[model samples]
Target: MAQTPQQRRANERFAKNEAAKRGRGSTIKPKQVTKSPVSAGWVVVLAFVVCGGLLLELLRIVPELWTSIAAMLSRLTG
Candidate 1:
């Protein structure tokens, strides 16, 4: 059976990949990924900044929250 151009190209790619897997023909190397230690440090810093901001917000709202709770309790009791 005659193969179309696309089918022939696909067959060539398949053969190349198979050859690479078997350590034959032109071997294709996978790209390597390397992470930077500085990036991990920056991630930790960002987490601390976010946590600090949330803590500050909670601290700022505590006084108002206490007032609201006190008023609610007075209404319920008196």
Candidate 2:
């Protein structure tokens, strides 16, 4: 059987009252302070190492990219 609109409204009002009653007992817990496992100097060093590796890889690929571009241009012109 289907419920009438009045029954649905009664259920909504009952839920709202129950939720408001439960909301009054809430307390906030203090947040804990934590320290980093690695030092700041190590983090900076790791960043530089990663950047240097990327730079080296880019330098190695640039010449091959230029060669590929040249090949494409030659094919287009021919």
Candidate 3:
């Protein structure tokens, strides 16, 4: 379907108005946003806390396990 002459003129007027607005710098440039380094730091801190807790749990369990194994070994050998 072809646009009528009136529709064509109206489209041209809209395009020209848009161009004029841009030429006059009616729009502002958006500011560059900076992300905080604190989020990365928090991630590292959380990893350390979780790993430390796991290590502590293992440390608590391993000695008791070792003693039990050693006693069984001694009884078997004796």
The most accurate candidate by lDDT is 2
Clashing pairs in 1: none
**Per-candidate clashes, comma-separated:** 0, 0, 0
- Writing each residue's lDDT as its tens digit, candidate 1 over 1-78 gives 999999999999999989887885556799999877678779999999999999999999999999999999999999
Q: How would the candidate models be sorted by lDDT, starting from the highest?
A: 2, 3, 1
> TM-scores of all models?
0.49, 0.56, 0.48
lDDT of 3 by residue, 1-78 (tens): 999999999999999999988789566789999988679889999999999999999999999999999999999999
Question: Using TM-score as the measure, what is the rank order of every candidate, best first?
Answer: 2, 1, 3
Model 3's TM-score against the true structure: 0.48
Against the true structure, candidate 2 reaches a TM-score of 0.56
The pairs that clash in candidate 2 are none
Shift of residue 77 alpha carbon in model 2, Å: 0.8
Question: What is the C-alpha local distance difference test score of candidate 2?
Answer: 0.97
